[model samples]
Target: MEVMQKCCVLFKPDTESKEMSGDSLLEVQRAKRAANLRESLFQILSGLYGIMIVILGAVIPITEIFMSEEIDSTFEGFYIYLYSVSILFLVYVYAYLLRRNRLKTELLTRTLSRSLSSSRAWAKGLARPDTDTKSKFRKRMISLDVSNHHTGTFYLRLGVLGFGIGSMIHSGLNFGSFVSVSGGDCSEPVQWVKPLIHLMFTFFQLYFIFMNSKMCIHRYKKLARFGLVHMCSTNICVWFRSIVVETLHVIHHSDTRGHHGAESGHHPASDNSTHARSYPHSAVGHGISHHGSPGPEYVIHDEGMEKTLVDNMSHVHHISRKLLAASVNASGNISSASKDNCHWKNMMSQAVEEAGPYLYPCTIEYSLMCAGILYIMWTNVGKRPRRPTRSELETDSEDDGVEDEQRAQRMSVDCTSSSRGLFLGILLMVGTIISIIAFYMLVNQEEMQDSAIFLTHMSGTFIYTVTLLALLLAAARMKNLSFHNQQEANLEDILILISYTGLLVFIIFSLIASILAETSTMSTLTILSNVSMLLQATVQTIFMLAGDRMFAATEKQVRKKPGREFITFLLISNFAMWAINTFQTQTPQHNPIQVDFYGPEAWAIFTHISVPLGIYYRFHSTVCFSNIWKNAWKKRKHA
Candidate 1:
């Protein structure tokens, strides 16, 4: 009877274990299904929100361009609409975060209070010390889950802040230009409201990004994803708008310049035939004598010249109408465009117009930076914090040690380490400055304009050639060093490649234009410049990628790092290239070969699309090279 009872007890435990196992399996399946459902919902909602924002972006610009009656009213309404929507969304997200933080705080407080009360009740008549109770409470508090806030590195944050400041300055200038317009009421609410809202949006949006760039949302995933995607789309929309406006401005100015040149009879020798071919009647009528009497030839001249003048004048009139409309308020009060306006207001307007080229780029850069940050935030939504395994922890520790060593090395690095490269870069920079000054000064003179263009292109060719040689040498040196193979491209590399496409596009077009255009000194220089840029970009990309993957091959070579000097030179050269492109290359007047070959409108379009990207590539390359110079080398300690 005892043996039978023992057998029954063992069988009973086995049955119970099987039941528990089955229940656990069911629970796991249910959890997985819930997770999968949540993921699907999130993805569906995200797609809907993205499509809505994209449609909004497309619709707003089209409406502003085609549907608006007056320029000032249209711009004012656009700003108000954009600012309102953006501010509302920003406030929504900000409020949500605040509420979440408050709830977390309250939960912690209540739990602590309950634990303390229980402890006090249990020890009411006991001899337990208060210190021990307090210690236990503190331990419990410390053991609670604390979230990890993965804010990015300090320099990246600083760069974003700096770009934001530039954008704010641009907005501030626009506000001043708007409010200081003559014949506009200083107290008019509509006149100043748009810019005020703009300023506020810029301030708040920048603050939000700075504070929460790396925030990961695990709860309220839908709302978080919506807000982040909206902000990203908004930035992209703004960037597109800015680019379009700048392109239009360029085209307008180019048309004006072309008209002025035709009126002044200062066309380039090669372009005169093209212009004559375009306006054959004007060519035929030019032989007539200029007099007040209406002879047959004089009558013909009047007809042809009038035809040409009317065509040119109509384009100019269209541009003027737009400009004048922008200066007039909704109340029909004309601002600086009118002869009756105040001289001071006119001066301010002119200054703003002149500064637009420089300010526009800043705004473009700002929007791009914001969009990138928001994209990162969007991708991080609903992600949970992962605990590192033992092997990963050890790897992290080793990486930390390497970082510390690199920091020490960077601190010890000085001019002596790269004196030759530094001096050469400084020399090149000084020469570039001189060349730029000379080019700008001469470009305004009718006879010296060609010379100025020649000098600019030649300077570009020289810089690119030198940089290409340096990159090649650096590549060869890198081949001697061993590096770990990186199977996947990182974010920086991906961005570099994307930006590089712009440069490549510009280069290819320029090369094609040079080949098809009449052979001249300018065309030859352009071909050289474009070729050098292409090769240099290719070699530099390889060099940077290889440098990024560099690791110590042996303990003996740990203290020696090559290519720092080359990187220093390349960094400065890229900055020089950026400045050149920003100031000189974008001007349609600078590359008359392209203008003559592709026509002013087509050339302007090409430049507007590509020059900004090229400028960004150079700027970003400098940042990358600086990083490589600072952090690529680390010393290993041997036991």
Candidate 2:
């Protein structure tokens, strides 16, 4: 009797399963609910801390930009308080994500323990003559189960830590820079405080990296026997996590292949061992796997396993989204209320409003990334294989099975019209051309150092264009597509939509900022760019949550509508700014602004970051707008 644990579910061959006692069933239910509640708490805490960090981060940049050059006593006090808040927020966010990961690890451990116990109990029943085989089987199976512990939790947690640490380091440096200027104007104690803060940040970054690397090495060594790290990924996540987290590997030594017709919803192509172990090709996020296992002739497969996993993960994901929504509202309201309050309250509110947009892109991106991770966890973690279809079984393609490879190559497109793809392609080409022209103008500046700003923008535009083209190609191949496909409207769709919208907002600001830079001083452009970013963030959020569905009234009113008011605004803004730049001349004596908002270095940093982001935004938006244009064109053509 071969007993195996597959995808976190224990399976026994040819033995009638005994029903669990009422007490055991009740205990299991209680445990499940308890685990779910714990997950919810973790998600809520993570979201709350994330919101706090974004709010604080936004304020820092704005404050730096507006900080008075005069060495007033109150100015130092305010700066110190702002930095202190940012540091605290950063620490909280990191701590929360770390705790969340720990919980996930605990859950995975518990599941593995149950699976091992079941496998062990079955092994104990084997005859004395087969003791050697039984012992070997038990060890291999246990090791394989342990290797499955490389859940996406590690990546998610690491990302959270990186964001927090990076923010801390940035804030520390900015605070140090601000205080260093205060010198004799401020007390000697304040000067020493800056050095201490700087040292702590530097030390924390170094120690954190070392400890994380050490842990990854340890995990690699521990799981080496199972061939876990054989084909490591180059993904940023895998690169930094090193070998600790890897894709699922088939345990060939287990000698149990009876996974055919396992669950009703499981795709038949998944039964192919090669497909099961390869990178996700079904429009799912990239995950690696290994295939070395051989299976039995029995048709019985573990059922209800996928449902169990989904039920749990869905609860956690839902909780996370809810937490985020609540946090967004609370943040907005707090900022609103702070407007008429005390000086500190006004400062906090001002930061929330001004910094909200600048810092918001990070929080929004993280949320979407988290959603993607959840989907990957749902599809790959604790997921059993299905029986291969006849065609799949007969195929000679050994590279992760023909069906999966084809699906992987096909690309996932929710739109079915060729016209849509054409329009999208055209939009991308136009945006590409515009970006190139803008790049040319910026590159022609007399100062070579300013080229960094141009190069950054150009690189982003180029990458954005490429992604747009890829998306256009993906959309062109669809057949009989509908936007409201129940399956298509899942969590993945929401994440993709939010991400594209966010990118579009960034691109808009980038183009505006670039256009303005041609005519304005670095300080003026920086201040206005930040303002535009904040506005974009505010509008995009409202549109996605409230206005997106309103567009469903007429397919023509879709969220991606091209030739909309926004495009008009973009065209006018670009044209007006460039025209001003073309006709105007700047002399060193001509200081045009009543306010100098940012340092020269700030301009450089903003350009470096915004240019790449702008490119991605323009590319993504072009494709989306093309789809909208196609929709409108199709309606007009039919009419």
User: Which candidate leads the pack in lDDT?
Assistant: 1
Q: What tens-digit string does per-residue lDDT give for candidate 2 at 1-639?
A: 233445224533322243445567889999999976865564455445434544544453333323343322222343344335434433542464333334334333433333434333332332132768656543331111222222222323344344334334333432333233322222245533643453353344333322221121111122221111111110112111111100000111010122222344443445433222222221111111111122222232334554455466444333322221112111121221111221223343344444322332332233233334333332232222232233222121112122554544522222332334345445644554565455456555656424534343343334333443343332342212233222123332354355445445434544443344334544344344444444543443333222211212344433333323332223223332222222211111111121111222222233223322332232223333332322222212100
lDDT for residue 264 in candidate 2, whole number 0-100: 45
Which ranges of candidate 1 are over 4 A from the true structure?
1-21, 68-85, 88-156, 182-192, 255-344, 385-410, 413-415, 635-639
Q: Determine which window of 10 residues in candidate 1 has minimal summed lDDT.
A: 141-150
Best by TM-score: 1
Candidate 1 per-residue C-alpha lDDT over 1-639 given as tens digits, one digit per residue, 9 for 90 to 100: 999999999899999999999999999999999988987788678768767766766575444444333343445565566667778878876676544344334323322333434333332412243787556433331111112212322234455677678677766766676677555323245656765676677788887776566456665677777777777776776666666555555555555666677778764343322232233221122222221111233223354665677666564545443533342211122223332333336665665666667666666666776777677677777664343233222221213222445646744553555667777888898888888999999999989987898898888889988999888776665565566573245445665676688888888988987787667787888898889889888877777767765644655443555666777788888888888988988876677667666655676668766877777778768766765665455432211
| TM-score, structure 1 vs. true | 0.74
